[model samples]
Target: MRVGSMIVRPLHHVILAAFSFIMAFPFIWMITSAFKTNDEIWAYPPVLLPDKLLWENISKAWHAAPFDLYVFNSVFVSVCIVLIQTVNSAMMAYALVHMRFPLGRPLLAIILVSYMLPGAATYLPGYIILSNLGLIDTYGGLIISNSVSVFTIFMIYQAFRQIPREVVEAAKIDGAPHRRILWTMVIPLTAPYFVVTGLITFIEMYNNYLWPSLITHNPDLYLVSAGLRSFFIEGGAYGMNWAQVMAASSFTILPLLILFIFAQKFIMKGVSQSYGVNKG
Candidate 1:
């Protein structure tokens, strides 16, 4: 039986490794194609390796659009979203998990249920609201509209719930006010969860295309995803620089990659706790 178990484990590992390679191939191909010329990028059977090794693709991509402004707008808007989302989520989650109040249970349930609500389903309403408020095409619109993420609320609520009530009760016994408990005890204890929430929000906001594209009519305010769409969709005179398109895609995804690498351990811990693997 032990030998059979060993054999099964190795087989599973091999299958998983192959699956991982399949999932990662597009990203690898994107990078390789970015370094190749247009012909090499779309060649039949696809060149697995880049021959040209030209840095020109990156240069062309950078010049093709207002990448710097897009990058700056993204960074500014996403940071605001991360800050607002994490802060609001932590406070709301903490309140729901640790404090008792009327209608609290149902309220928490409603918030969690919002996660299953698709953004596309709400697009028309969201657009109407933003336009009505004169927020259309403005940074104010995007940041305000996407600020409250149900996923962040739900995930952080789980993390917040796992923190022992005993510790909080002890703090209360020591005469810690509600605000003191939240600021000093609860927030400090849940720093890992906060980091996890921020990372998730950053990734989502950075990659968001549809809402931004719909609201933002000006090229100056285009996001990376929206800018890429313009090249791929709009067949103008300079349409479809395949190498440069791939290069821009590579840059668009790089920040998310770096974030995952930096916060890998914390991310794993957060998810494990979310799964009830660790309650404290």
Candidate 2:
């Protein structure tokens, strides 16, 4: 048994190494191409390594548009969405899992049904609602539209259900108020799921493009994804510049990369715990 286990360990490492390379290939190509010259981009059987690195192309991409402002906007919008989604989802989940409100079961069923309807189908209706509220082209429009992430509410509800009723009754016996128990006992028990929800919301908002493109015409308020699209539309003949496009892509993805690198395990572990999977 020990000898067989020793042989399986190296095989597992080899398989994992191959999987890692497969997942990382596209990123490797993008980084290499971002630093490559125009000639290198079109070279047959393209060289992965570029001897003449072009910093100027990246510099031009950085300066050609309002990247600083775009990044700042992206950060602001993503943060707001994360917070709003977390709070709204938590509230809804708590109501579903804890509160015995009228129409509670039907309400959860409705929420689940809403998840079946794709966002694309609701786009026009959502836009009309935003226009009616006079929130178009404003940060309020962005944040409010994403307030309730069904997926998040679903995950958080699972975590909330895992909370033992005995503990809640104990809190009540200790004279802890309802809201106080929710904040202290309930939220503390589900803190890990909350972080996971926040991370997922942040990634979603950071990468969104179509909604921002349609609603906000003002160039200044654009997020990174919309800003990148504008480069191709407004940059004209220079828009075809692969170097600049790749540079913008690299810059846009860098923050997400860094964030996931640091928070990946935490989010994964949290979600797994919520769903009772992959317990460590």
Candidate 3:
């Protein structure tokens, strides 16, 4: 059995490595194509590498649109949404898990059920509310509309459940306020869950296209996804400037890549911990 296991483990790793390369090939192609000339891009045999690196492609792509503003808007909105959701999720999850109250279970159930509903179902009402509040086409609308996230609440709820009730009771007996106990004990113990949820929320908000497009018409308020679309249509000249398009695409996703690279360990740790908690 041990010998067979050893053979299977290496085979499993090999399969995973092959799949990883397959998934990454497009991104690799995009980065390399960014430096290729137009002729090389459509070359008969398909050019994996350019004959000469054209650094100008990067510069031209950067200057081709208001990408800097787009990036800033995306980063700012995503960060704000993440922060707001984290706090709201943590507090709500803590209450649901640790504090007993009337209709608590029903409230949690309702929230979870809402998550099961299609997000598109809520867009019309969400837009109407924002319009009534006169927040349409504003950053406040974007930030406030996404301030609450059921997924984050659920993630944190499960994490909080892993904590022993005895610990919370002990803190209560020691005269620690609920807020104090939550901030000092519960939050620290579940930091990994928060990090994982925050990263997920940031990515979702950053990549959100349909809702943002529907709400925001001003070019200056456009997120990265919208900016990329505009660039593809206008600055890219309908794919005539393939090199610059590739270059723009390559840099646009750099922030997400960097974030995932830095937070990958925490994500893995969080998932493992959650799994262990469930098994326990």
lDDT, candidate 1, 195-215, per-residue tens: 888987898899888889888
lDDT of 2 by residue, 62-138 (tens): 88888989998998999988887877887788778877889999999998998999889989999999999998999
User: Please, what's the RMSD in Å of model 1?
Assistant: 2.4
Regions of model 2 farther than 4 Å from truth: 271-280
**What are the lDDT figures for the candidates, one per model?**
0.84, 0.84, 0.93
Q: Write the candidate numbers in order of decreasing TM-score.
A: 3, 2, 1
Q: Measured by TM-score, how close is model 2 to the native structure? A: 0.93
Stretches of model 3 off by over 4 angstroms after superposition: 1-6, 234-238
Question: Could you tell me which residue pairs clash in candidate 1?
Answer: none
Minimum summed lDDT over a 10-residue window in model 1 is located at 231-240
Backbone clash pairs in model 1 (N, Cα, C under 3 Å; residues 3+ apart or in different chains), count: 0
Instruction: List residue ranges in candidate 1 displaced over 4 A.
Output: 1-12, 275-280
Residue-level lDDT tens digits of model 3 in 1-280:
9999999999999999999999999999999999999999999989799989999999999998888899899999999999999999999999999999999999999999999999999999999999999988999999999999999999999889889999999999999999999999999999999999999999999999999999999999999999988878645564688898899889988889999999999999999998886787
